[model samples]
Target: MAIYSCFLGKNLKHLKIRLHDIKLATHNFSDKYKTESNGHTTWYTTELSHFNKEKPSLVVIKHFLPGEKDDEEELFLTELEMLTSVKHHNIVTLIGFCVEGFDMMLVIEKFSNGFLRDYLGNVKNMRTLTWEKRLKICIDVAQALNYLHSEMEDKKIIIHTTLHNSSLGLDENWGAKIEDFQWAIFLPPNNKDGAMSKITYSNHSYYMDPEYAKTGMLKRESDVYSFGVILFEILCGRHADDQIYLNGSEKGLIHVARRKFHTGKIEDMIDPTLKEEIGRKSYVPNRGATKDSFYTFLEVAHQCVAEVQDQRPTMKVVLKELQKALFLQVSQLYILS
Candidate 1:
C-alpha cells in the first residue's frame, strides 16, 4: 500500500492527511456521516475543518454500506478523476481523495458563504442579494458551464446531471462556484463508434427537462433547461418546486411565472422581500428604479426558461448577456456614487 501526501499550492504542511487519520481524528465514521431519512447522503458539520484554521478545507467522507454494488464504486472513482482533472476559477477544486477499504473521502476547498440555495431560500438574505449580485452570480455560473461545455478539450460537452441551488456555492466575495460533479457525464471521443455518449438519470423533478426526462435523451439543451429554472429561481426568490399564490389560487412557481410572463405581468413574479423602491410591491413605482431593474431581470429569466428548449440561449450566450447586465448595473452605481 502506498501512502500519498498531497499539498495545495506551495504549502507542504497544509497537506490533506489520509482518510485513516481523518477517521481517527473524528471517531465513529458511521456517526460522522449519517444517512438522512430520504436516503440521500447527509454530511456532518463537524467533519469539515474550521474555515479559520490554517489552510482551511472541507473533508467529505462518505462510507459505503455493506454489500454495495460495483457500480457505486465505479461512479465514485469516475467523479473523483473528473474533478481532479479540471481546474477553473468558478469550478470547485478537489484537493485530494482517498479510497481506503469501503470508505471514500474527498477533500475540497471550502467556500465561506455557503450554497446559493441558502441565500435564495432565506427571506432576509434574499433582500441582501441585490440585482447586481444576482447578475454576477448568473454570469459566474454561466462562465463555468461554458468552460465545461466548450473550452475543456478532454471533457467537452460535460453535462452536470444535477444542477440545483444547493450545487452552487458562494465564496466570501459572494461569487458563485459550481460544485458537486459526481453526476457529471463527459461525451464520448470522436473516434469511438457506437460508444454510449450520454447519461440520463432521473433528476430532481423541478429541474429535469421535460424532453430529456421523457425520452432519456441527454443533450446540452437539457443543461439549458435547468439553467432556466435556476434563473427563474433567482429572479423570483422561490424554489422551482415551490407553490405561489396567483390569480386567487395556489400554483407552482413555474406555472405562475409562465402565465404572468405571457400576460406581461412580469413584475408580479419579483420576490416580496425586495423593497418597493426595488420594484416588488406596487405595479408602478414613483422612482421607476426598481421597476426597470425587475423587468429587465424578468425578461432574461423568461428567455432562459422558455418552454421550447431550442429557443433557450447556450451558457456562452447567457454569460455574455449577464455580463452586459452587470456592466449596466455598475455604470448606474457609478453615476449614483
Candidate 2:
C-alpha cells in the first residue's frame, strides 16, 4: 500500500495514519460498526489503541465513497486542510487521516451523545432537552461560528456553507461541537465574501440563505441564516424537512415561522413541551422558558432569517443575544429558588 506522500507532504506526514489500523479498529468497515451512511460517505465508530494514551480512544472514521480520482483527491485535501488548521472547544477535532490506494478516510474524535439532531424532532427526546440545555447548545454553535468567521488564524475566515442540525455533534455532557467541513470555503484576511457560481446542494434546503440562493453570492451571513433555522428547530422541536412545513406555500420552516411572527401568533410555534404551563389547579414540574427568554431568542432568530441578507445579524451579535436569552432563563431560576 503506497502512502500517497505526494499529497501528504512532509508538513502533514505526521497526520497520515496507517490504513491497516483504521481497518482493524473498524473490523474492515463491518456493517455492525457503521453509525451513519449517506450515498456519498459512511461513518463508523471504533476505538483506536495506538494513540499512546492510557486507554483506547474512541473515534469516528468518515470514509469517502470512491469517485473520480482527481475530484476525490481535491475534496479530501480541502477538508483536510481546513480541519488541520483550526482548533476550538466547540469545533470537532481531527485526530488523523488515512490515504492509501483507493481508500480515503478522516479519523475524528467521537462524541458519546451523537449528533444534535438525535435529540430533536421527537417528543420523548425533546423532553430531555430543557430550555437551559437548548440555550447552551445554541450558544456553543454560535461561539464556534463566530470564531470561524472573525477569529481564525491570521484573521482568515471560513464560510461554513453547510450548517444544519446534523452538522452539530454533542458530547456526553451535552456540549455542542460543529462538524462536517467538506463544503466549507476559506477566505483571505479582510475578504468578506466569495463568489461560488456553483452552489453545492444538501438536504437542508430550509437552511439555505435566500439571498445566496438568488444571487450565488456566498457570505458569512449565509451561515447565520442557516443557524437561525437550527434555532427554530430547537424552539419548535422539529426538523427543517418536517412534513408540516413542507406542506406550506413556501415549503420551509422559515416561511411558516416568519408568517407566525408577523401574525402575532409566534407563541403557537413553540414546541409543545416548551409550553408547559403552571396553572393554579395543577402542579407543573417544568414551567419551560420565561417570557423574556423566549421572546429574546425569538427576536434574534427571526432577524437571522430575514428576507434581506443585510438585515441578518453578524455571528458576534447573534452570540451576544443568545447569551442574553440564556441569562434571562438562569436569572428566573435564581429568583424562584
Candidate 3:
C-alpha cells in the first residue's frame, strides 16, 4: 500500500488539472475541438490557457468512456495508474487528467498525423508511408515495446493487449507513438500474465497471443506476435483484424505468409506502392534495403508471428534486427531521399 501511495501521490502532484481549466481549454467541449472518436472514447485538441504568453500549445484530451458505472470506473483507474506509472518518448505522453462529475478524461500529447491505421486503410494513402518511412515506423514501435518489455526499471512487464494499427499514432515528425493502453496489463518481470477481461471474450481474441490464448498464460512474447502482425501490415498494406479473416479464407496476412513466405512468392505480399518505391531505386540494394529486404524483414516478422510463443524473439531482438534493416535502407530511406 505504501508503494501504491507513492505512485499515486507522484502522479497527482504533477498531473492533476482542474476540470474548469480543461473545459475552458477545450472551448467548453465544443464539437470543433474534437479531432477523433470511436464511439467509446473521444479525443479533442487544445492548449491550457497561457500563463506566460508562450505559444498556444496543442494537446490531446481523451474522454474516459461512459457506460456501466462500476466497470468503467475500475477500468479508468487501472488505465490511469498505468499511464501515470509508465512514461516514454515512443509511447504517447500524458500531460494531466480531469475527473469531474460524469466526465473522466486523460490529457495527453496530440499527434498531428493520427493513427498508423489511417495510412494502411486505403491504397491511396499507402504512398504516405514510403518503404523507408514504414521501416522506421516499425523500428519506432519496436523500441517502444522494448521499453515496455524490459527498459522500465520498476513498471514490470507492461503488456499492451491492443497493439494494432489504430493504437499506433504518428506525431508531427511522422514518428510512431504507441497509445490505447486501456487493455494493457502489468505483471512481475517476465511473468506470463493476462489482464482481467474487460470486453467480451471474442473481441479480446483479435490481437491475442496464441499460446496465451490457448494456455491462458500471457507472456511478453504475446506482444512480439502482435508486432509481427504489424510488420506484415507495413509490408503488405492490410489490416490484421479478424474482419479480414472473417471475409475470406487463406487471405489473412498470416495465412498468406504461412503458405508462400518461403516458397519464393513472398514478393507477392509486398504492397504495390512499396514495390514501386523500391523499383525507383537503380541499385537493387539501395543504401541498405537490398532487393531481398522484404524477405529479411518478413523473415523477422515470420519469427515474430510464429504460432508457437517460444519461437518468438524478444522485443529487444526485434528492435536490433529492425535497426539493422533501417541502416541498410538508410540511403533510400526517408531522411536521405
Candidate 4:
C-alpha cells in the first residue's frame, strides 16, 4: 500500500491509498471548489494535477452508480472500459478510474471555463460571447459528437442521452468538449434482421427525445434530437424547459423555434441580447446582427431541432455548417474592424 499525506483544510490526514485514492480525493476537492447541480454525480477536488502533468488544480469527480452485486458491478466496469477507450481532442478525456468499490469512479480533465450552462448563466451581459466564439463552440461540439458517432473503432454509436448546456464544457481556447458519458449507450452493429441493439440505460429528463421519453427506445436519432435542443439553448441562451410557445401546443424551446422559423420570424426566437449586438452598428433598419450569416447559423440550429428526427442533420453535417458560419462571421468581423 502507498501511504500519502495531504492537508484537508486545517487538518492533515495520512492514509494508505491506491490509484483510486487520487481520483476520490480529486472528486471531493472539485465539489469543494465549484458550484453544484442536481441529478448528476460529481467529484470535487482542490487540486487539478490530473488535468495536466504540470498544473495541479482542484477537480470534480464523477462516479458511476454502483450495482447491487458483482454482476451489477460489471456493468459499471464495462462502461468505464468503453469510455476509457475513447480518445479525442473535442471529447473530455477520462484521466483514470477506480472500479474496486461498489461504485465506479472516473477522474477526467477539468475545464477552467466550466460547463457552457455556467458560462451563459453567469455572463451578466448577454452578448459577452461573441458571434465568432459562439459559432466556434458550436462547431467544436458538433465535431466531438461526429467523432463519437463515426470515428471510434469497435464502432459503437455513443448516444449522449443528456445533451445540454450543462454537459458541454468550454476549454481555455473557447472550444467546446462533450462531457458526461455515463448515460451514453453503445449501439451494436446492425443485426441479421437489420435491427440495432442499445446498451446502457438513461434517465435524463431535459435532453431526452420526446419519442424516447415516451417509448424508451434508444437510437442515434435520439441523440440528434437532444443535440438539437442543445443548439437551441446555445442560440437563445435560455433553457429548453423554460420556453413557452404562443400556440400552447408544446413548451420546449426547439418546438417554439421551429414554428417561428417556418413563419419567417426566426429572429423572434433568438436571444434579444444577440439581436441587439448585431443591430448596434447597423446603418440600415431591420439589419441588426440578424444578417444572412447569423440566419445561416440559426437555420442549422433549426434543422437540428426539427420535429422529425430524420430531418435533423447528423453531427458531421452540423459541424460543417457551423464551421462555415464561423468563418464567415470572422471574416465579417475583420471587415468591420
Best by lDDT: 2
Ranking 1 against 2 by lDDT, winner: 2
Q: Per-prediction TM-score, please? A: 0.79, 0.93, 0.85, 0.77
- Per-residue error for 8 in candidate 3, Å, reads 4.3
- What is the alpha-carbon RMSD of candidate 3 to the true structure? 3.9
Candidates in order have lDDT scores of 0.64, 0.84, 0.74, 0.62
lDDT of 4 by residue, 1-337 (tens): 0111111232212211245556455554354544453333434545545435587654545654443444334444444555665777888866655444444555666787777777553436345666666777878888878877777776656666667777788788877888766556666653111123343334335566666655567666677777877777777767666635424444566667777778887777677656765544542222234365676787787777665566768778888888877776666666666
TM-score (C-alpha) between model 1 and the true structure: 0.79
lDDT of 3 by residue, 104-145 (tens): 788888788878778875888876677668888899999999
lDDT: the better of candidates 1 and 4: 1
lDDT value, residue 7 of candidate 3: 46
Once superposed on the true structure, which residue ranges of model 2 sit more than 4 Å away at CA?
1-10, 277-287
RMSD of each: 5.6, 2.6, 3.9, 7.4
lDDT of 4 at 63: 52
> Relative to the unseen true structure, what is the C-alpha lDDT of residue 117 in candidate 4, on a scale of 0 to 100?
77
Candidate 3 Cα misplacement greater than 4 A, ranges:
1-8, 50-53, 190-205, 241-247, 277-281, 284-289, 331-337
Candidate 3 positional error at 289, Å: 5.1
Please estimate how well model 4 matches the true structure, expressed as its whole-model Cα lDDT.
Answer: 0.62
Candidates 1 and 4, the one with greater TM-score = 1
Top TM-score model: 2
Please list all clashing residue pairs in model 2, or write none if there are none: none
Where is the poorest 10-residue window by lDDT in model 1? 1-10
